[model samples]
Target: MDRNFARALSLVLKSEGGWSDNPADPGGATMKGVTLANFRRYVKADATKAELRRISDDQVAMVYRRFYWDAVAGALLPDGIDYAVFDFAVNSGPGRAAKYLQAVLGVVQDGRIGPATLAAAGAKPAGVVIDALCDARLAFLEKLPTWPSFGRGWSARVASVRRQALLISAAPLTTTVSVPSAPASADAVAPTAPPAGAGPHTGAEAPAAPPESVSPAKAAGILALIALALGALTAWAAHLPCNLLGVFCQ
Candidate 1:
């Protein structure tokens, strides 16, 4: 694997406390504390002592495989897919991560960590998820150094790897491209127009017809009609031919 890739893998593994000589035994550890031993057992529920040892070996190999290293031949990953797969494996376990990649790539979601699935893992080219994992690993490393004596070496290794991963992640493969400017042409220039009606254009809105003003005489005529109607009502009330008051009294 590339030195950078190896360094990154080592850092992640170290951050997780997977590289310790006195690695915790998975069999008796409680899940609550979540020591390396418990984590291994959580991933490999049915393995025996010998089998458990083998799981450790598998874990290392899976890490390399996902991160672009050939465990048997000792080769480095040649593509970003390996990095992504490695990250997913580290976060979700090899089996579950492979399954997710398969589902994302639309192959099969059998949860088997294999070459085809690893190949599919690279389908999403952007390294957002892997970068996120790297960030997490860095944070874990920063805190690991303050942990108890038993974790010192592991913590140191994690811290080292975290620094390396950050460096690698910093040098992104993709770059942003600026939009090209159009050439200045005579046709592109907007023409200047003369002010208002001075040129062939008139920018002013036409004057609206003045609202018909009500004359005082027209208003007085309406008032006079109303007054006349009121006067006729008063005359009727004062004893007209109908004589309503006289009839009521009778």
Candidate 2:
């Protein structure tokens, strides 16, 4: 509500030019065909539309609460950037703009846009689109007689909201497990250690030692068993006789 804050905000938004052209700009020249009173009437009528109402203050505030970062202070970005991002979110949907900002800022690439993404975006070099938007907001703000005072209050609110957004965005993320070693080789197996307080043999009965060598016949028998099980399953599935049907099917 500080007048100075509004003035500063108005200055920043006014400096950016294209904002006056926004469809939401109450005084846009594009709406000149309609009288001011008629325009207001149309706005009131449109406000009743479900889609417009869906994008009401509550929805916008929800999104604002998600991305507004205050703690970093004004150092992360100018007041214009905050206004621009919020407007972009409201107009284009927060998810898309957040993703675009993430891409612009080189943050995590998951596209569900949010505060961390916007903060990251603030770190990006201003591009053509960003510059144009900043210009528009600045231009729009500058034309308003009350902009100085209004902008100050709006900027303060934005700052507070941004702080909340940052906190939400900074919440601890879920963690994942990490294995310390590579998978064991096909031929390698885990070694069993002797139990505590035992002699060389150990306290409890020692595990059976692994075989030093494997016989070809034993391996062949194991393969035969596996083949038999697979044959049975195939026979059941095909509803065929086990032997001849199995050979033909293969």
Candidate 3:
């Protein structure tokens, strides 16, 4: 696992802080963002509310690193992207966070990060995916039923993540992908090259321009000409009966 991820994750854990039990929050009785239910599940020991009040920071960090970070494959992701995804997973869930990254990468949204996801993420620039993911996250948060009560805080958190992620990703080594010295084992399938026209087509020819518009005066003149032709036709039709007969009938 990337050591930098742990350092950055520490910052996120700090921001999340310790112990919140707002009635509006659905998590209910969260300590360091780990709810009472999760803590019980992770610890696997029955503890009273009084004991939960004494939950340590170290315990929280372990739960986050194992359940949240490892689940999302944070160590393999780009620096800024890992933090964004990790924090998002903590806020939302692992499945949603993985699916969100997949959505931005334009890959399968199976809610699990695997070979395909890692390959796509590594191939693309981190900034582009980070921007898109953050935008999508905000748009999603805006539609939630709880937005009226928690929208401001959610928006601020996303913004903070976006800014910090970008900053972390801006580091020289952050975006670099390392290649293995030896070939992969038999089970590993190497990433294939993208198909033709798969990447951005910068040199694509511009579309043909639309036909020019005619001025109002020019349009009126054309209409007048059509009217004159109709008038002449009418006059010819009116004289047809007289011309067909031996004498004038009109």
- Tens digit per residue, CA lDDT, model 3, 1-250: 3666666677677667777888989888887788788788786478655666688877777778888899999998887889889989988889999999999999999999999999999898989889999999899889989999989988989999889888888876656788978864655543455467665424443345579999999999999999999999999988887788867674
Candidate that scores best on lDDT: 3
Over 4 Å off, model 2:
1-143, 160-188, 194-206, 209-250
Q: State how far residue 102 of model 3 sits from its true place (Å).
A: 0.4
* TM-scores of all candidate predictions against the true structure: 0.31, 0.25, 0.67
The per-residue C-alpha lDDT of model 1 at residue 90 equals 50
Q: Give the per-residue lDDT digits (tens) of candidate 1, residues 1-250.
A: 3444565465455445423234443324222222335445445565444444344544654445533233211123224434444544554355654554455566777865456654544344435434444445445435643445434554455345334544454455545668999886644543454366553424443345569999999999999999999999997676654574356431
How big is the RMSD of model 1? 22.4
> Candidate 3 lDDT (Cα, whole model)?
0.83
Provide the RMSD of all predictions against the true structure, rounded to 1 decimal: 22.4, 24.0, 25.9
lDDT of candidate 3 at residue 60, scale 0 to 100:
75
RMSD of 2: 24.0
Model 1 steric clash pairs: 1-75, 1-76, 68-77
Over 40-146, each residue of candidate 2 has an lDDT whose tens digit, in order, gives 35344444333332343343333233332221122244343444454444333445444544554567856554567556655654343355444444444556676
